[model samples]
Target: MERLQKVIAKAGIASRRKAEELILQGKVKVNGKVCTTLGTQVSSKDIISVDDKIIEKEELVYYLLNKPRKYVCTVKDEHKRNKVVDLIECKERIFPVGRLDYDSTGMLILTNDGDFAQMLSHPKFQIPKSYRVTVKGILDKNDLIKLQNGLVLDDGYKTMPAKVSMTSYDNTSNRCVLEMTINEGRNRQVRRMIEAVGKIVSKLHRMQYGCVKDDNLAIGSYRRLRPHEIKTLKKMANEGISE
Candidate 1:
């Protein structure tokens, strides 16, 4: 037996939290009876429905997508913009684990496992994400030190210390390339950090997420994650939960 929300989430209907909301709103039914309680439990034999439509648990699927710019990382966009899910042709309903900014290109994971998504997205995990950035101005040694030390953002929250390294600089273009690894997943964080140091970000690309890397995956393309990779991620997620 499992909690109603957990069952709904495992069925690829919604995240656990969203599942609870659906229950609260009296949208969920168990064995033909509406269930609004948060702790309602049911076994596999029990009938489950949301909005009167019966739902069945789906086999979980995972994919690594090298997201391209101009694609939103969401299941649906209010503006009718193309979403990352739309890019992948899959029969099972899957969603991006987390978001990459609309304009930033990089590696993204899409999955139907809500528990896996929750484990990775939680800030407590401190999963490291690496990015390569191009900025309009060259950064000196002192500037690099400041970035490594951390900075106070416009929102008054001080960023966590990040690993920043200079990759290259063009004297003629006054542009600099930097690689940064950060554990925090703040919105526009890398760009904000560069802007705080008086530099304008021209381009940004994610190189890696936790143990997953862009590798040879082409932009706007995707592939299934190998067994070993999935095993490693599940291990990481379990370890994070235990801690």
Candidate 2:
């Protein structure tokens, strides 16, 4: 037997955490009975339903997408905007592993493997994510050092120390382009980090996640992750990685 939420997540219905929320909302049922309990367990012989639809485990799939700007990273958008998942034509119930701001673009992972999603997304794993960021103003050595050493955001949350290096500075435009790698997954963290440093992020693009890179994927296009890419990521998740 396994926890109901785990089963639901493994079935590609939702993430384990979201599955728990569905359970508490009475949206999940087992053997025709509504179950709001968090740890309720079930076996293969039992019937499982989420929102009245029966669920069975799905063949896990993983995709690496070069997301385009203006696409939200969600399964459903009430505003009817373009969703990242809509960019892929897979039959599995795949969802974005983590998120990027609607206006931010680049390396995004979509997968139906719930445990793999949890492994990379969970804060404890500290999987390094690399981003190419362009800010509105030139960042001095002090600014770069502050970011490298970590700074407190407006919300009083201090970010973990990051690996920050300036790639270019345009004197004419007063814009600075830099590469930053951080392992923590705070909400809008890169943008917020720039805000904390008294700069505005004009453009933000994730370049890599763990061992996976955007490579030659065209904007809004996706492809299956290579076997070694997935293996290296899982190893990084289990053993951690350096910046």
Candidate 3:
């Protein structure tokens, strides 16, 4: 059994917070009776409907993709560009956990589980994400420090503080492999943070997100999350699924 608001939210009726409002307003009905209580508990056996629309339980799916550059991270593109789901080619609906810019690439988590999806994508969780970035010019100590700290983006929002280190470098080519760890996921964050510090990211590859790492997985190939990996992820998220 689960809270009625959570069941309503999982059914895609509304957010959990909003579902409570609907419930209190007498808009939700359980077993053909009005349920105006905020703390109602329900199960699959309980017939639930909102605004006369019967709720349907969607199948939960999880997928991992080594997203490649030039492919957008969305379920459907209005302009018909290739999307991340195009690579998976699965019937179970899935959505990208976080986003990778069109010019960036790396391990992307996809799932149809709405609760897991909300936890990973929302800012509160602050799931650590690591990136192996290649910069155009050699970044010095000052350059590294500024990117290590937060900054006001071009859009005017201050970036969250992060961890940065030089994993590899080439003085001759002026390119450096910098490992970046960020708790917050923002649009074009790693690239913009570096660029704001007077350098350009030539190539960006995500090495880790949350506790999961690519670990020699071939590009354009993917595999299921190992049992141990799933367990670790549940531990990190501080939540678990019935599966």
Candidate whose lDDT is highest: 2
lDDT of 1 by residue, 1-243 (tens): 889999888878887888899999999999999999998979999999999999977999999999999999889889999899998898888998888999999989998887778778877777778999999999999889989999988888798888999999999999999999987888889999998999999999999888888579999999998888888877876676321
**Residues 1-74 of candidate 2: C-alpha lDDT, one tens digit per residue:** 99988898888888888888999999988999999999997999999999999997689899999999999999
Q: Candidates' TM-scores?
A: 0.93, 0.96, 0.79
Of 2 and 3, the candidate ahead on lDDT is: 2
Which ranges of candidate 1 are over 4 A from the true structure? 241-243
Residue 21 shift from truth in candidate 1, angstroms: 2.4
Root-mean-square deviation (CA) per prediction: 2.1, 1.3, 4.7
Against the true structure, candidate 2 has what lDDT?
Answer: 0.92
Between candidates 2 and 3, the one scoring higher on TM-score is 2
The lDDT of model 3 is: 0.80
lDDT of 3 by residue, 49-112 (tens): 9998888887666677788888998777998887887788766666677799887888898776
The top-ranked prediction according to TM-score is 2
How would the candidate models be sorted by lDDT, starting from the highest? 2, 1, 3
Instruction: Give residue 125's error in model 1 in angstroms.
Output: 0.7
